[model samples]
Target: MYCNQPPEKPGNKKELLEKITNMARANSLWVTAYGTGCGAIELRPLHTSRFDMERFGIAMRPTPRQADVLIISGYLATKTLKRVIRVYEQMQDPKYIVALGSCTINGGMYFDSYNTLNVLDKYLPVDVYVMGCMPRPEAIIDGFSLLMQKIKDGRAQGWKHYKENLDYYRENQKKIITDWDLPDYNW
Candidate 1:
């Protein structure tokens, strides 16, 4: 009825298929490596042979459109927060955000800066928070694992939350990004 087809009723087959799909998505997570702030430096080793993120099926993609996971690391100034919102909007659905460091959660040392954002969650939905002054690669991997498990269990629904609460998020974003020029929908 909504599209050209009739509305399908809920059933066991649908649930089973959803579970299978979730498992597949959980394994094939593609991270968007956005260089937000000083925290970006700590993420360098994750791709090297020492960490080898691919072993866990997590690889960094160059663009937001191709990435499934966005890692917000370091202190986010208002300028960076604007770009982050734009990138987050560009990413396709079923996306997830992994916030790294105490800086991202509560602004860390940059808490007093008028230009830096104190709380990232006020602007975007964070699926996982890897807490540290600068979390170690092992801690980041552990965070990724937690995100994967959440994805597998079909609990990582930040994308849906973002879409549903678009107005609330937009207000928070606009408050920080005073010179808003981007369109409401990038796509």
Candidate 2:
């Protein structure tokens, strides 16, 4: 059942196929980079020659529909959280979330701010969390690698959990996003 283990044969053919598919999906992660605050600047170096995230099969997608990963790269305001939730929902199933910077973890400097939410997991399930006010590109790359491993291990099931607990997530999102302008279902 371990991710690094080779797929078993015969009776476990279906399971073996699933494991192979997961490995392929994990290796080819198309990211939707949504930078909501100051940490957005750090992502710039990822595309440059120095970091070059593309080398790891991590490329940026123009739309959420085409992306397999959603990188929430900074502080999330109430207004922005609404949009973030919408975008996250729009992405296909088996998606992963990478929460970068201290802001998304515990609100960072905005911990006491009225418009910001301290913990991201309360509304959206986060698969990987890269700590620091603004994590370096190396840390971001590491986070992505960790996420890939999680996907391979079948531990990155946040999307499936969200679908099964839609009402609970919606209530938490609605509590902070008072305006509630979006429809009941994002799809």
lDDT of each: 0.86, 0.85
* Candidate closest to the true structure, highest TM-score: 1
* Candidate 1 residue pairs in backbone clash: none
lDDT of 1 by residue, 63-127 (tens): 99999999998788888887888898888777999998988889888899888888889999999
Judge candidate 2 against the unseen true structure and give its global Cα lDDT, from 0 to 1: 0.85
lDDT of 1: 0.86
- Per-residue CA lDDT of model 2 for 1-187, tens digit only, reads 1222332333565788889989999889998877777878999999999999888888999899999998888888888998898899788777889998998888899999998889999899999999987899999899988999998998898877776677788889989887888865554
- State the lDDT at 133 in candidate 1: 83
Report the Cα RMSD per candidate. Answer: 3.6, 6.0
